[model samples]
Target: MTEDDETALSRPQRRLLRRIYNGRTEPIVVEGLAFLTYKEASRYLLTLTEEAREAAYQEMKRQAG
Candidate 1:
């Protein structure tokens, strides 16, 4: 698949992409949430409600800045 053609990817393919692109060998902890892998963190983000997702993004921004 092309780099821009994410819509065509299956869930497993997406997870694999996240694992490769995230560049983290260990689990990621963000806002006290612990993920088994970057792929898991990405999957968790997808499950959040819109408000919660925005809140998490804002928190990440705050920490980064």
Candidate 2:
């Protein structure tokens, strides 16, 4: 993202982006749309089931370990 784009995101959004990026090596996609920014992905993440979130967390740990 450009400097202006980075500055446009709120602190929470920036933090969310960091967390999401840390968890995966690939862009998040939902229903065929690619989520390259926190604004686009946060809603989808918020809507995930607990089981799905846990699965994603496990995958992140697996990748980290």
Candidate 3:
């Protein structure tokens, strides 16, 4: 690696994702949506209330059982 290469690498392309989150690149299967990006998916997940989250968890558990 040279000075020129280092300079080029300094400017990194920003990803379309939440910087604070531990993210996955795969699609998130929500109620009726397949969110392609963690950014979009994370935002939608944040909007769901605690009751909605619990209901979803119960439904998933029931299906698995």
Candidate 4:
């Protein structure tokens, strides 16, 4: 961020921005609310590898049997 942008941000805002820039993949609590970084949200995507899906399917079928 530019000097002007930094100057405009509160201390907590700057801290949160720094954490995001440094690739922190956890929720941050502000006031009483929790916020997830973009990196953390992306980690929750439902995509799975083919091998992983096949293994899970086999496990489920085995359990059903």
Top TM-score hit: 1
For model 2, residues 1-65, the per-residue Cα lDDT tens digits are: 45664554446645756676654657665455566545555445445576664454344334334
* Model 1: per-residue Cα lDDT over 1-65, one tens digit each: 23444333346745554544365445445678855554454565566776775565455434433
Candidate 1: regions farther than 4 A off:
1-29, 34-40
Best first by TM-score, ranked: 1, 2, 3, 4
lDDT of each: 0.52, 0.53, 0.42, 0.39
For candidate 2, what is the TM-score? 0.39
Cα error, candidate 2, residue 7 (Å): 1.3
Name the Cα RMSD for model 2. Answer: 7.9
Q: Model 2, stretches more than 4 Å misplaced?
A: 23-27, 35-65
Q: Look at candidate 3 and give me any clashing residue pairs.
A: none
TM-score of each: 0.42, 0.39, 0.37, 0.29
Please write out the lDDT profile of model 3 over residues 1-65, one tens digit for every residue: 33453232112211212332235445545577765543454455445576774454344334323
Quantify how close model 4 is to the true structure by its C-alpha RMSD in Å.
17.4
Q: Native-vs-model 4 lDDT? A: 0.39
Regions more than 4 Å wrong, model 3: 1-26, 54-65
Candidate 2 CA-lDDT value: 0.53
lDDT of 1 at 21: 38
Query: Local error of candidate 4 at 12, Å?
Result: 53
